[model samples]
Target: MTGPSAVPPVTVLPVGGHGLLVELPTAEAAEALHAELLRRRRTGTLPPVREIVPGARTVLLEGLAEPRRLAEELPHWRVPPLSRTGGTAVRIPVRYDGPDLAEVAALWGLSEQEVGAVHASAEYRVAFCGFAPGFGYLTVLGAGYEVPRRASPRTRVPAGAVGLAGAYTGIYPRSSPGGWQLIGTAVDTVLWDPERTPAALLEPGTRVRFEPVDSAGTPIGDSADPDIPDPDIPDTPSGSREPR
Candidate 1:
C-alpha cells in the first residue's frame, strides 16, 4: 500500500530446526529480497545456506548452519525493486479454450477473443511456486486482470489446464482437485518431467509469457518476443517452446 512501504520492515523468526522465516510486507519486496539472497549464495558469500525459498511475503531460509546469526543479520539486507531483468523467461504455448473461458470473459466485460488477446499480450513472472510441484504462481503484467476461483472446486482438473486466481495465473501440473478459474490449456507441454534436468519447467523469479495457439495446436500469434531461451529448462518436448 502507498507505493510499497519504506523498505518493508523485515521480521525474522524461527522456521524450524534449521530454517528461518524472513517476513516482508509484500510479495514484491519478498521476491526482491529472495533474489538478493540467491545471488549471494551463488557467489559463495552466503553463510552455509542450502536453499532460499520465496513465498508470497516471506523467504524461508533452510539448511542454514547458523540460523540465529543469519536472523540477526537479515535486517541489514537491502532489497531492490523487482526488475524485468530479475529472472529468466520461458515461452509457453496455450490454446485459449477452457471451461471457464466464457465466464472469465464476462467477468472482465470482454468477448472471449478479446480476453484471449489481452491475456496473451501481457508478460508474467513466477511470483512463487507452490500448492503443487511444477505449478507456478505467475503475476499478471497488467492490473485489473484478476479473476476469482470457481464457486465449486473441480474434483479433477487435468494437467496443463491454465487458470487464473486472485492476482496470479497458474497451470495444473497433474490431475487434481482445484478451484482456480480455468481460462486455457498449454499445448503438449510437460509441466513436470521427473526425468528432465529441471523437473519443474517454471521456477520462482522465472519470467513467463503465454503464447496463444489455435484449434490445431498451431501458434496463432506470429512469434515469441525477447526470444532468449532459458538454458536450465533442458530438452523439452514439442508444444512447450519452439524456434522463433
Candidate 2:
C-alpha cells in the first residue's frame, strides 16, 4: 500500500492530429498516470481513445475524440503512485553465463556469483514496453541498480539475452543490435508469441522475478519445475534499439 509522497506534475502536449502526450518527471510517475488512465477507461469515465501507450517518462493517448479538452484536463488530474501489488507475476529462469558478466561484476564491485544473487533477489515491474513488440522495460522495486551500456554496440544481440542499461532490465525478443550490458540469458522464456492471447509475455505493471539456474537448468536454493518451452529463434534481426 506504500506509494509516492506526492503526485508528480504533468505536461500535456498535442501529438499530430488525434493524440495527447502527457509527460512526467520520471518513469514511475508516468506509469502512475498510465494506470490511472486505464482504470478510468475501464470504469467508463474516460473519453474514448484508440490506444494508450506508456513510455520511459511519458504517456501517449492516441485517437482521442476531444484532444484539446483532455489535454487541458490532464494537468489537473491527480495521478496516484502506481500500486505494486495485484498484478500478474512472472518468474523467469536465467542462466548467468552472459559474455559481459565479468564486466558487470566489476562495475558493481561484486563477484559474478554475487551479481546473479543480487539480481535474482530483487522484484521488478514492467514500467513500459518499447524498443520491440515484446521487449519490456522492467524497473527494480526499491532498488537503484544502474549500469552503463557498452562503449560499442553489438551487431546482433541474440534472443533471450537478459541485459541491463541505465536503471532498467530487458530481454531481447529477437536478434538485434544493442548496447545494453548483458548479464544472463532467460531460459525457455518466450517474450513474444503471435499466436498467444496478448502476444507479449511481459506488459506494463507485470511483476517479475528472475530465478537463477545452473547450466543443467536446476534452480539455485529452490526445487521447482523449469520445463517451460523454448521460443523459436528467428534468423532475421529486428530493427528496434535497446531499452534505455
Candidate 3:
C-alpha cells in the first residue's frame, strides 16, 4: 500500500437513519478533517452536509443527500490537506486536586507534581465533538501519562473536570456522570447560548494546554500562554439576538 491507496478510502454507507461512517487512517488525520468540517459549517460553505462526527480514527457525516446525490456532489467537497493550519492553542486553568488525582498519579509511576507536569506539557488537539454539546475529546497525552477510567463510574463529574481515559483526555462540558480518571478540574465556561456569534469555546482545530490551579480550584493566574483569545461564549441575551 502506498499514498492514497494506503489510506482508508472514504466509504459512504447507507444513511442508517442520519449518518454514515468512514474509516480514517490516524487520529491526527481524523482531527484535521474534523477541523475542516467545522470551519465549513461555521462559514456556511459546507456542501449541504449536516453533522460531521469523529471517532478514534473515523468520521461520520450525517444528513447528507441521497447516496446517489452524494456520489455526484462529494467529489467537489474540498477537503483540505492534513498539514493545513493546526489552529490556535487554548491554555485552560485547572486545579490538580481532584478526588482521584492521587490514584491516577500513582498509576503513572509519578508523584503528584510529575503527573501535573505531564498533563501540562502536551498540546492536545480537539479530536472530535461528542459526549455532549461543546465537549471536546482530546487526543493522546504526552509521555509518562497513560491512565485509565475509574474502576466504577462516578455519579456525577462536575463540569470542567479534566479527565483521562485510555489514551484520550476529555473535559466535562456540563455537570454530568462519568467514569474517567479525574486528575484535575478546569473552569472554562465552554457552553453558551447560540445567540452569540460564535457559540462553542473549543472548536475542532483548537489545541489545549492545561495550567495547574490552586487547591481551591481558583485560577492562580499562572497561565502557560496568555495570548490565546478568550472564546466569545455569550449569555442569554435580553432580546438582543434572534434565535436561529
On TM-score, the leading prediction is 2
Residue-level lDDT for 68 in candidate 2: 89
Candidate 2: tens digits of C-alpha lDDT, residues 1-244: 2243544567888899899999987676787788999999999989999999999899999998779888888888976556766655799999998899999888877789777877777667889998899999988623335788899999999999999998888999999999999999999899999999989999988889899999998888742223322112221112211232
Model 3 ranges with Cα > 4 A deviation: 1-10, 17-19, 36-46, 69-86, 142-144, 191-197, 216-244
Clashing pairs in 1: none
User: What do the candidate models score in CA lDDT, each in turn?
Assistant: 0.79, 0.81, 0.67
Ranked by lDDT from best down, the candidates are: 2, 1, 3
What's each prediction's TM-score?
0.84, 0.85, 0.73
Clashing pairs in 3: none
Of the two candidates 2 and 3, the one with more favorable lDDT, higher being better, is 2
The TM-score between candidate 3 and the true structure equals 0.73
Q: Superposing every Cα of model 2 onto the true structure, what RMSD results?
A: 9.6
- Strongest candidate by lDDT: 2
Ranked by lDDT, the better of candidates 1 and 3 is: 1
| lDDT for position 222 in model 2 | 40
